[model samples]
Target: MSRSLFDVAQSIASVERSEIRRTTGRIARSRQTCCKIMNGSGSPPLHRQGMDYGESKDVQKVHAAIQREKQEPRVGLEPLSLWLIGIYALAVFFGGAYLGRFSGSFSGDSLDPGTVPTKSHGPGPGGGGQQQTAELSPAERGKKVFMSNCAVCHQASGLGSQSQGYPPLAGSEITNGGSRRAAMVVMKGLQGPVTVKGQKYGSAVMQLWESLGDLKVADVLTYERQEWGNHGGPVTKEQIAAFRKELASHPGSFTEADLEPVPADANLPGGEEGAAPPKPGEQAKPGAPPQGSVPPATPGAQPPKP
Candidate 1:
């Protein structure tokens, strides 16, 4: 019995050893196949055959999707359309031509619509091509000065603001009368209550314009007197100089009471002798003798025979 048990034990040991060797060989083969797949050098092992078909199909789908995608955009790479390029060229050409034609010497004075550029004059007998600028009339120059300095209070229309106490210059008795009163107001300035065209103005005060000089004061007064349908005569610088001398001792601005002493028909000194002739139907003073007309025969004086 002991001998039979020993033979059975030996047989069992040999079968166990064979099973272990088979298991070791299978594990080694699997490891080698896995390394080969990882290295990208061998076909799939038999155990991984089921997964190969699925992986290859997925890779093919990914490649197809990539091939169908649009390319990335790059700036300044595509050529501009022919029509667009032509339009831009046309715009540039026309714009340049327009600017060249309308821009006159690119000067500031050329921008005024009322001003016409004077053509260059050829060399004269004196042998010089003199470029002369257009000269402004006294009234025109006065208008510019008034617009810059006095337009804020009196306004461009000559119709002053009644609510603000500025007296209107248009058709006013003070402005339409002789140059004496107007010259007085301009030279010394004005304050206090004043009646113009029967309307009273008192709140606003006028500053001294004596510093404007005789020429500017005369010019501005001439413009105000002649403008807005007033029949007052033009004022001269000589008249202004004479008036300035008369008022040399007078202090400060004049009030309405101060102006009352001066007669409405009184003309400024030197105005009749040196000032320009009044416009047609205009008068230096209402009912005054017309310029250049000889006075009627004075009280039995012998008249010249025709």
Candidate 2:
């Protein structure tokens, strides 16, 4: 508790003690009456009844604090909510903009210079598989779809990290594609060394993410497939689950031949996709670079000192 609150409690306890009450009573009643009469009312008495003032200004301070607490907004998010939102927001925001720039050739079209998925080009070929449910946030509903399946090797970002022999998602060929094609790929994991956004990404067979139910898997796949510039179209949870059901007979990972790129103008991959490759001729900043290698673009991007 705050020091002021502690002091107020202490003062209240003291006042309740027999000795303190006796002491206050011993004070000249005539003098106490004179002070109250001078003020026209016994405000000090009323204040003590509510809360005792150990110091002269404590009563006002306590009342002010109560008033301030009452004035605060009731609908504000908690710290955890703020953090989850912040991380997801940053993933979509920075990740979207970053991915938009490296879309092979279609990078900036849908994710152009702003947030919010751009307009659609019309229902895709398999439009029946496009319906999505409103039950959960794209991320929340997508979690189950992602966990039982997606967490296998690509881990999360869909980009799979190099340390784990997976590619990065900040820029990935798969994330930079269309919906139908991406959904199919989700149902069937990827394989081989592939070229994403003009860069080569070689790898072993990846696990299939088709284990989730259609809506659950579809929504999640759609979310990951679309976010970060892999535009494509909406992958219904039903679509994903159905594919998983179909593939139940053979339980092995998929190869590169299993995937196909979505069409262009389909907003296939929606945004720019890629970590800004460090600029050439740029030096690392003072605190940049782990151990020994220099950081790219940390220098020279700054304007010359005035």
Instruction: Name the candidate that leads on TM-score.
Output: 1
lDDT (Cα, 0-100) at 159 in candidate 1: 96
Model 2 clash number: 30
All candidates: TM-score? 0.52, 0.35
Query: Residue 110 of candidate 1: its Cα lDDT?
Result: 58
Model 2 residue 247 lDDT score: 63
Q: In model 1, where do residues sit more than 4 Å from their true spots?
A: 1-117, 123-129, 273-306
Cα error, residue 105 of model 1, in Å, equals 17
Clash pairs, model 1 backbone: none
Model 2 ranges off by over 4 Å? 1-135, 147-152, 155-159, 226-232, 241-253, 258-306
Tens-digit lDDT track of model 2 for 1-306: 698899999988876897867777878775787788678766544444443342355677767655654344466653467888889998899888876776656743432212233334447774544444333444454555555556666676566655555665544555555444555556666667655566566675565655444656555755565555554345544444454555678556555554543353233222322232233345556765443345576655885598
Worst 10 residues of 1 by lDDT: 47-56
